[model samples]
Target: MNSLLKCRYCGWVGGKSDFEWDHMDPKIKTESFLLDFLQGKLELICSGCNRQKSDKTSQDYTFWRWLFPRQANFGPIRAHTFMDTLLQRIHREIR
Candidate 1:
């Protein structure tokens, strides 16, 4: 059997050695993680992104923007509604 790690948000599969073992906030997880994120309670952040994001926001990477873009013309749903869609996508693809 092959061992691989995949990013829950983007589905980027990586080797075990290259992956970080982490989980969503214990109180949130996938089913409730989205709610936490939108309510300013949860952060589905990646380790690599720690250097960039803090309490407010960051522009260096694409994850935050992709998930919660200020401009709403492109994403399939608005930031508020997309939180659910994003979580659904993560569950369907990675969980």
Candidate 2:
């Protein structure tokens, strides 16, 4: 049986086929490409959200309609933690 998975960005829950892996930070330009290789840099989100996010980082509000409402489902604490982890990963890549 195919177990259901939830989108880390949106609250969409469905089978694995409905989702795709998204980079937590998509704007990183690295010579060795170490950023994508790091842990906590990937998230499983729905294909629709993935396409909407495009190459923009989560910090970018270009897709506010898709991002903000869905993020609210995470509540304040989980949302803060999510953003904190994303920022930490970006900082790690920078240093």
Candidate 3:
């Protein structure tokens, strides 16, 4: 039987076909290109969640929404870590 993976951002769990790889730490402006590139910094996430995450490194949800202006409303059905980050951001915004 094929093993199932759970998304750290969203609580989605299913077969390999149901998920996409998300780079927790984007390789855009890292100091060591080769090291970062070769490292296993990927996490399994739903395709829908991947779209919202894009290349953003920040775990902040509002920032995520802002990053993908066109898909502001689009996001994981239930992102556990993302929601935690969102709650943190909310408090920061309030202050």
* Model 3 per-residue lDDT tens digits across residues 4-48: 877665566777776866667574545664555477566667777
Q: Which candidate is the best by TM-score?
A: 2
After TM-score superposition, the amount by which residue 81's alpha carbon in candidate 2 deviates from its true location, in angstroms, is 36
Clashing pairs in 1: 36-42
Q: After superposition, how far is residue 49 of candidate 1 from its true place, in Å?
A: 5.4
Sort the candidates on TM-score, descending order. Answer: 2, 3, 1
lDDT of 1 by residue, 1-95 (tens): 88765544444454553333233333334565456566665433333332233333333234564876553122111345668888899999985
List residue ranges in candidate 3 displaced over 4 A. Answer: 27-37, 61-95
- Model 3 has an lDDT value of 0.65
Compared with the true structure, all predictions reach lDDT values of: 0.44, 0.66, 0.65
> Of models 1 and 2, which has the larger TM-score?
2
Distance (Å) between predicted and true CA of 25, model 2? 0.8
Quote the positional error of residue 58 for candidate 2 in Å.
1.6
RMSD of 3: 13.4
lDDT of 2 at 71: 49
- Pull out the clashing pairs in model 2: none
Better model by lDDT: candidate 1 vs candidate 2:
2
